[model samples]
Target chain A: MSSIKPLVAVLCAGVLGLQGCASERSETALDQAAASFQAVKDDSNVLRSAPRDVIRAGESLARAERLSSYVGSGADVRHYAYLSQRYSEIAREHSNLVLNQERLAKLELERQRLQLALREAKLVSVQQQGKWLEAQIVSLATTQSDRGLVMTLGDVLFDTGQAELKNSASRTVLKLVQFLQLNPRRVVRIEGYTDSTGTPEDNLTLSRDRAQAVADMLVDLGVDEKRIQVEGYGDQYPIEANASERGRAQNRRVEIVFSDEKGHLGAPR
Target chain B: MALLALAGCATDPAPHEQMRLSEQALEQAKAVGATDEVAELKLAEDKLARARSNMASESYRDARLRAEQAELDARLAEARVLTLKSQEQLSLLQSRVNRLRKQLGEQQ
Candidate 1:
């Protein structure tokens, strides 16, 4: 009987050690869950954006605490604790998403407001430059042709054999943008022409690139891209003979053909 | 003794509903582009597989706990992916706004 008593005591000690280990694990999990809950519970943003999740965290933590007092309930306690921590994390993340979305909306509005201000400032500067420039653009550059109302951008706006429009071109491009904005229903086809100097293929590519560059600038200045059509004639439709430098310069030009106010465009050549 | 008897009688019902919920949560996370590369998604997937096995073996209590954990893990993964995407969008807009501001400054 004495031997049996010692053996039983040893068995009891082993069982108690296992229980203590399990409880220790459960205790750590419970502490972690409590910390997570404490961090998010008082956060106003989390409360506002994820109130239900925060409530669930609190409830799960409470359940875990309750289960920790029961014998052999360590698994249940840990499970609830893990769930509680996850809920806290989810709540925090949800709040962050909501705050970011709110900021995005505000930023988008600011961008629109800034865009409008910039447009107005540009128009003011163009007006300050002179009303006569507008008259010159209408009378000198624009003409009524069979294709439609055409406005020519002379070769001086670009360097020799280059597709990039010079900084000097901004004024003209801005004026074009303003015209399009004012006549919203009218679309424009920007046709590029080059002198008969380069290979026909190179001329074709350069002319297309120049037209695309102008179209890109118009888009950057807030013109709707759908209203712009680009075509490259590649020495096919020269305004003057390409034999002399002066004549070649005249031939290397971009012409803007405007659609009628009803948005009717001439067929592509 | 009575408490032990009550506990024995209170065998947990099979967590079919919880398993379904966890599966739905996992699908939702995946739908939002949460791949196995996401640690939370991997953890959720592992736990959910174990939970399925537990369910098949009629270990309802274990299955319920695992499914519950998996559901939250998947939800957290989804929330993390969404938050990350929003952060990316925020930076993109910030750069665009800065560019606009610079252009406006240049114009002025």
Candidate 2:
């Protein structure tokens, strides 16, 4: 009987020790849960964005606290504590999401406004550039009684016997595009002329191809194709005699004849 | 003895409703793109699996507690995923706004 009594006492002590350990663990969990709840409960942003979650966190913490007073309720206390901590975390995350969404909305509006402002600024700059280009074109042109305003593209703008305009022609072409854009009512006839070195048939085709190439470039640069006409005059009207290299070079030229601001292009020669 | 019996009766009802609720919460979290990569989601899945076994063994109280914790864990995982997505969007918008500001300054 004495031995049995000692065994029972030892067993009772072991049970008590286990209970003490469980309660200590539950106490730590409860403390952590309470701290988490406290942090979010007082935050106005959290409350505003996630009122339901904050309420749940508070309720869970209260349940954990109430269960902590009972013996053998350690597991229940810890379970509620875990729930309370999760609710607090969910509340904080929700608040952050809401705040971020608000910021995104404001930034989006600002971006749109800035985009509009930038577009307006670019248009104003283009208009200023158009005015400068118009002055340059006017100085480069000559007044002819029959052709109205005529500008000449020298033969150096293209390789010999090739209709393709060289890269150096981009500046002049861009200026012409700007001039046409500013004068929307005006039209131009692009005339291609070749020197007498090639056969008349070959010269005619080369002249047409050169004129068409220039027209294609103007259209690519945003000019309306309907505003321009192309013509090839094969060695028909030479400004210089085809005897010297310089004279032939002069003869192989493209001419742009502009209307008098009325959209009436001169007749093709 | 009657009070003890009542306490036991109260806890012995199988916790079928809590189990279903936990499962639903887990599914909802997964539907929101919460994978096992999320620590909370992994914990939720493991606990819910244990809760199911506890239910099979007639440990109703343990099953209920585990299911309840699992539901909250899954909910926290979903919330964290959404918060992370929002943070990414915030950074993207911030960079776009900064680019616009730089372009505007250059234009001036």
Best by DockQ: 2
- Interface RMSD (one decimal) of model 1: 3.3
What is the Å distance of residue A149 in model 2 from its true position?
A: 5.1
DockQ of structure 2: 0.32
| First chain TM-score, candidate 2 | 0.55
lDDT of 1 at B77: 98
Local distance difference test, candidate 2: 0.87
Clashes of 1: 0
Off by over 4 Å in 2: A1-20, A127-269, B1-10
Standalone chain B TM-score for every prediction = 0.91, 0.89
CAPRI tier of model 2? acceptable
Mind giving the per-residue lDDT tens digits that candidate 2 earns over B20-107? 9899989999998999999999999999999999988888877888998898899889888888888898899889888988988888
Q: How far does residue B23 in candidate 2 sit from its true spot (Å)? A: 1.5
